[model samples]
Target: MHEQLKQQLEHAQAGDRGALARLISVLESGGSDAAILERCLRARHGGGYTVGITGAPGAGKSTLVSALLGEVLAEPGRVALLAVDPSSPLSRGALLGDRVRMQPHAGSPDVFIRSMASRGHLGGLAMATRSARRLLEACGWPLTLIETVGVGQVELDVASATDTVVVVLNPGWGDEVQANKAGLMEVADIFVINKADKAGLDATRRDLEGALASLPPERRPQVLETIATEGKGAAALWQAIRDHRAAITASGELEQRRLAQVRSELKGMMDALLANQVQRLFEGQDAHARVLAVSEGSLDIATASDQMLDLLYDQAAGRV
Candidate 1:
């Protein structure tokens, strides 16, 4: 680790807000700068609870998160929000429009709000989401809220990364079918039927209940109702989240989930790094020659794959 990098990381670990921001920028730009990440990981008390709020578009996820932010601000601790927005396809840029909806608490020192674009990433999360979470964790924020890009099925992946997954649903928008789907149902720790002030709230609740009834009691997630825009039922939602956490803890499932998440993240990072390295190595190379050989029956796809793997392994091992 360079002295300067170490200092920046140390400052972040020491709760220097500015240093923490800079560390996040470095990670967002794809710079490994492993020393900083290592320090941040080590400094992590892992005390924070990351709550993921996700659902279909127009389900009032943003409003729910904004209201929840307000509720969390009233408490006696730091809180951070990571709002993930869908990226523009042509420009491959994320507009982060949700931040505009959260302008009321923008200047609060105890609250940190960040708008992250998905950058056309497949997982419905920002490219630097993991690192961003680490940065927030390093900054002494005891709670982190991740508002995922609500793109239907893919949003389920967002749940695996959080301590608790809250799937916010609207009253009449395919509520039953969404809940019955394997992906969303499996990932939901708690279900929030937001916009409960509207009609069909009971129907939505029944739909969710019926779907959950088929699952084993131990696998069922608690369901809550919220009129997020008016801040109604927010306390009950919060209490439900806490109770869910307590249940997971008592069942010894929280540690298992954490370990699984860590392993998944590590594997994803390694896979991306390896793929990038392989692409760089083979760029503008004689791939045509290999293809031609394979076409002519002189080479096999398995052999080609093995060759590529060998090259990648060698490069990773510093033997290239």
Candidate 2:
């Protein structure tokens, strides 16, 4: 297994598209090979810039991303695009509708596009995307564009993972201002008023500008208007993102932010591992019997919980 992973990693590094696809597939599924691959990639990782584009559905996020892809690829370098879509509640599979919208760059060797279902992650990103971004960096892609599930402004994990966060909004976003205050406002490094050809554009832009002006000058984000379908403002938006990245790099804030995210990821992993163990224990016959016993009043809830805790500790210790 180790030797096979090594070969795949070598091929991916050497720019073999098939090998890189296999590597990304392994990482996306959170398979057995994933941790090994991530560790290997971590050693070779020269960090690249990740830009996260997030906002409400119908905000033209896909169109903006398509435009930005053209802008980014104008300079020669590999780019990886992850279009995260909402998972089907029953099937838990991605609809992958974003891929159809991004078909313009389908054949670009320097551009690799992948669709990921959020898989019930309410944060609007597949849980594996951070690892995938690192894998992209290791595979020699110098830039990654993460387009969120477009569930709305509440999606913040993509912002946490990326170096720059671009929040896209439509012309009628004024009424949603209060709801967005907690989500997009805090994460946006740049605000994009997409679909500038639409009528309420000036009003939407002012709403954004007014809210931004009330903040301290240093915390203000750049606001730009874009007609994504016509390819109107992508270049300026890209430049704003680059400028923000450069500013954060010189300010040492980028390292500070990434360190915090790493700690968050580690703690999240530990919590999830423990939760999965507890869940497995609950699925066992003995645990089921205990649950039925509690329901029948033969066992109290508190006592049953104590017994479960004991079992958990025993099981964890045995594994250790």
Candidate 3:
């Protein structure tokens, strides 16, 4: 690594927010430097607890996150928030509306807030969010909050990336059928009924309860109500978070989940590398010739694919 990068990492570990921001920017940009930085911090990662908040748009997720910060900061240690937002079609940059809503804590030395663009990535999380979380962990932030972009039925990448997944919804969110169809049910560690002051609170709670009835009592996520706009129930929500963490940690589930996450990340990296290699192989002269032959009916696609695989194996074996 470069001298400046090394100095920045050291400064970040010592709690220099500016240096930490620069390091995260480098990771988001991605290259050899980012790879080297990740390698350097590999042993130091995984210190903090990460919480993910996700829900449909207009669910007041940003407001709930801001409200929760008050409860989180009431204690001693610093916390970091990574808010993911939709990308602008023109610039592909974060809209940053979440940052605006969370500006109350922006000036605090102990609060670090970052807004990331999803950039058309599936599952409502930015591609760089995982790396940023690792960087925050290495820097000694005891708690990290990840607020995902507006998600509907299927966006669930946040669950794989965090320790706890909080799924937010409004009082009149939907019927039991819709709740059951949403993939959120599969990953939510806690269900937050934000805007609880609105109508249909009881009905919504019942629907959620019914949808979750299949899970064993010990496995069911608690459904909490909150009026985030008024900061109502924030303290209780934080307490519930703490209780859930304690339970998971004591049962050894926390460590298991983290190990599973590392395994999944490694698999994703391998898939990406393999995809790149496959693309390169397809663009090679021999593969192009095979493609032409197959298209001209002089060779079958199966044989052509076999030949390409043979060529790839030869290249890998240093016999090309």
lDDT of each: 0.73, 0.78, 0.80
TM-score of 1: 0.87
Candidate 1 per-residue lDDT over residues 1-320, each given as its tens digit: 56776788779768776887776656655544743464446434657678888887778888788788777777788888877655553454433447677888878887777766544332324346766787677656788888876745445565568889998887875844454467778788888998888999998889779988998998899888898879897888877887888998899988888888777777776666666676776673655667677899999989987887787677778996
lDDT of 3: 0.80
lDDT of 2 by residue, 13-70 (tens): 8888789888777766564576677668662244577889888777889888999999
lDDT by residue for model 3 (1-320), tens: 67778899999999899999988777766666776777766632446999989887778988999999999888888999987655554564534567788989899888999876533332223446777888898889889998876664323675556899888888888553264445787788999999999999999999889989999999999999999999999999999999999999999999898998888766765665566667889888998898899999999999988888888778878998
Error of 2 at 301 (Å): 3.3
Question: RMSD for each model, in Å, please?
Answer: 3.1, 3.2, 2.9
Tell me how far the alpha carbon of residue 260 in candidate 1 is from the true structure, in angstroms, after superposition: 0.7
Model 1, position 182, has a per-residue lDDT of 72
**Which is better, 1 or 3, measured by TM-score?**
3
User: In model 3, which range of ten residues has the least summed lDDT?
Assistant: 118-127
Clashes of 2: 0
Error of 2 at 67 (Å): 1.5
> Best candidate per lDDT, number?
3
Q: What is the TM-score of each predicted model, taking all chains together?
A: 0.87, 0.87, 0.90
Better of 1 and 3 by lDDT: 3
